[model samples]
Target: MPVRKLLLGVLTLCYPVAIYFGLQHWSPRVMALALVALALLRALTSRQAGWRLLAVAAAVLAAIVAASNHALPLKLYPVLVNAAMLGLFGWSLRHPPSLVERLARLREPDLPPSGVAYTRRVTQAWCVFFVCNGTVAALTAVLASDRIWALYNGGIAYGLIGAMFAGEWLVRQRVMARGRHG
Candidate 1:
């Protein structure tokens, strides 16, 4: 639970760097084997449904990379992750009380009507961000150099997410202030 909650995101982001350096020292098949071991270990340690789904996806990707003897499949992990997040957030929109709303409720259980609307909009915005980010990731994986892929996926991507978090927090504060004053 601790690893899944705290460390999983960092580990996931490191995938690009791992593959980039791994190919320098090992064969694609060997790298694929390592990925499978990591996935299996994570699966065994975590009971989260989301992690289980990701484990299956990772195993399939590993199998493809092993058989194909290529890094393309390995590089698609970010795209796959974004797709999964989009699915989760989009599904929540249809089911009501969106993903962001659920997170909001964790801190403010009795969110006002305005807060609910804001969270829904925020979830939709995240869906858009996931789509755009995944598309760029896929393009880089297919067309860009391994170094570029690692740079963007491991570095720029996290920076963009941090920017989004900061931007949203600023916007939320302004929204709350407006609600209080108006």
Candidate 2:
């Protein structure tokens, strides 16, 4: 019931739903608008700077969708979305009590500094992964003139998410092994 878990669950469900409706040729503009509205609501309720930035990015994405309706450029939408997500990620990273800090707090009080450092590194790596994947997805959509949902939700989305999950597991395993040894 934690906020992080709630966000993760919402994202997990929303991604597939977005992909499904998008592939069906639903109005991307509407989708973008809805997201923007939600982001705006969040921003209004929370005083956090990160949430405000997210709201702005969401609004920008809505504008991109509206623009794309007039002229279907290959790289336009994807590039815009990727840049927005990257900017949001960067903003979140800059703020305090980031993902790394949250994860570290979950650990035992007596846990070594190395473990905390490892967790921070892993979280940072995950942020980088999001940036790289977003860039690739955006570029592919823009240059290929293919449907963004189809391309991103197909092999690319699965592969990237799977790889990140596996990488996280591997890091956790190594951390545990080191803990056992020490």
Candidate 3:
């Protein structure tokens, strides 16, 4: 499977897990420990050693925060993780068009017919997952009478998801236009 497809699948799974963890109000220790485990797994499997190392470092920091049980660190960790995710998505968006051309070059004539279709399906699934999860979070926040933190965190998650959707749309538009005009 292509890296893009794999990433989309992972993100789809992560989105729901994040929402579940948030809704459960999982203790910082539990959340941090889980994320650390995830990071370690990602690091071990990732092709990029540098990013893998960074993930390891993030895991360590999360472990420390969990151990300390500090409110400030707990509050900051979510924001930091969200920022990192946003940055990764943005970087993917900013890649040069030539990269796609290179992918086209690399394609084998005998490649399976399902490859492209499968990628599209995965990408679309991810879009739906983000939209639904984000909407649910936002609505729960708005409807709840108490828990200001829930409302605030939900709002942020919704905004980030919206941003990602908008970015994806822009990329699709650009790609379509290039296909038509090129």
Using Cα atoms with residue i matched to residue i, what is each candidate's TM-score against the true structure? 0.94, 0.64, 0.43
Candidate 1: C-alpha RMSD after superposition: 1.5
Clashes of 3: 0
- RMSD of every candidate to native, in Å, equals 1.5, 4.6, 9.3
Ranking by TM-score: 1, 2, 3
Q: State, as a TM-score between 0 and 1, how close model 1 is to the true structure.
A: 0.94
Best by TM-score: 1
Q: Report the lDDT tens digits of candidate 3 across residue range 1-182.
A: 87854874475345333644553686666766656765666676678765576576667767786778643343333444444544443443355322222343375444343434433443444545444554444444345332443444545565666886687668656765775698
Which parts of model 3 have CA positions greater than 4 angstroms off? 2-27, 71-78, 85-182
Name every residue pair that clashes in candidate 1.
Answer: none
Instruction: Give the Cα error of residue 4 in candidate 2, in Å.
Output: 13
**Candidate 1 residue-wise lDDT, 1-182, digit = tens:** 47564565566667789888998898888889867876786687677788788888989999999889998888888898899889999999999989999999999999999999999999999999999999999999999998999899989988988998899999999999999999
- TM for candidate 3 is 0.43
Clashing pairs in 3: none
lDDT of 2 by residue, 1-182 (tens): 66854764465335434544553575665556555655566566667686567567656656776777522321233344455555654555677444655656777656577766665676577678767777776556545544554557445666777987787888788878988997
Summing lDDT over every window of 10 consecutive residues in candidate 1, give the lowest-scoring window. Answer: 1-10
